[model samples]
Target: MPRPPASHMPIADALRARIKASEWQVGDKLPSRAHLAAEYDVNPMTIQRAVERLIIEGLLEGRAGSGTYVRTPRERLRMVRSRHRERRGGSPFRADMAEQGRRGTWESHSQARVPAPDGIAVRLGIAPGDPTVRTDYEFLADGMPVQLSTSWEPMAITDGTPIVLPEMGPLAGMGVVERMRSIGVVIDTAVEVPRPGRATQEEANLLGISVGDLLTHIERTYYDTDGRSVETADITVPDVRWEIAYEIGIEQPEQD
Candidate 1:
């Protein structure tokens, strides 16, 4: 009888090396939990834990009713925050993907006239009961899920306007700056704060990753010339999928 693999084989690391070695080619089913457990002389729960870690690492995929299989790693894309990339008319995401020779698109669902939550109210500088349009978005690059966002716009700024629905109407696909500009609101600046977070089950499902994956959470707000917040959003992207970059242009101080 073959020495049942190696009892000391670090389960997760051992499996990861096997997958990397092409022992299990992409789409090839991994060993069953029972099989792995028996071979390692460990509990099935131990095998499950190992598989879950690989899944979170995006090395393996789990299909309902089917066994786990190796997954191909995609190129890590750069999401740029720069003056030109932040322009209106075109979606920054779409433009970034195009620059990288990939196609990008997004789906958004909006609920109109919802009362602002306390936090949202503060962000938009509106009363708690103020009407707002809430939009949820999932962005895809080359047909792969890449980012998710939830945004709120106070109806006080967009009520009865052609651009109220965000993803609907004539200015539908335009960026917030352009949409607000069409209504005579000059969007002079935007702000964003990025933080680290762990992917929740719901976010994992939506982004096609595993729970506990690393995610970058961004709080983004658009302000007009008068410093009034026009729109605010919370955006999340899988850290493994994209690299975040910021570009700032420095101005010359007058030499005179």
Candidate 2:
């Protein structure tokens, strides 16, 4: 049986479908809520709510005293990281650094307890208020800030190690992985999360870009063999200088 539309189909769905159909192109102003209400025979408030939702989703933008207009799609920035199993084999960051002959100095390190952010807490499987060790670094490539990373480790595991020492040197070459191994925490998997957002003031200064420029933020979490979370890190990179590549495969269907 064909099911009917739900009792309350969100008005945004209709607007989104029309936009996708090219009824409205980028920079095109959408009709006012009153006009849409008259056309759809729905309440003006419903149309307003729908338009608000579209704005929040980046599909539309509202101009004060003007009207809501479609937003143009921005260029996407790419980032590269090793896959889960590949990380276990070798560190991609180390390989890239060696290939480019890049050198960096240890920026800073401190052992202070900080509450985990909502996203970090969820990824680490810890309570939001749980304490964690935070390490901040600014990596330079050819004397320019190319990578900014902040790493967090749960106090329970890292308190006994020199994980927060400033003189630890480049993690890729410094046998930090070996240290973790000595501690009996074998990393089995690493997961990377990519997020698109505007660069912060500090990031803008470091990357030599105007504040609010688009950037690709990445957060990586490493898991130990016992299924426990070992480390979580956040990295930010300028959108222009890097590209992410992926490989995909397609399986053929059975003979018809």
Q: Which candidate is the best by TM-score?
A: 1
TM-score to native of every candidate shown: 0.81, 0.57
For all candidates in order, the CA lDDT equals: 0.88, 0.68
lDDT of 1 by residue, 1-256 (tens): 4433333338999999988888998889998998988887877777888888888788888999998989888567678878777663567778888888989899999999999999999999999989999999999888889899999999988999899999999988777888888999998888999999999999989997779998999999999989999999999999988889989889999998
Could you tell me which 10 consecutive residues in candidate 1 have the lowest summed lDDT?
1-10
After superposition on all CA atoms, what RMSD does each candidate show versus the true structure? 4.3, 9.9
Q: Give the number of colliding residue pairs in candidate 2.
A: 0
Relative to the true structure, candidate 2 reaches a TM of 0.57
Candidate 1 structure, TM-score to reference: 0.81
- Candidate 2 achieves a global lDDT of 0.68
lDDT tens digits by residue: candidate 2, 131-199: 887777776655666678888777777665654442353343342355466567787677777888777
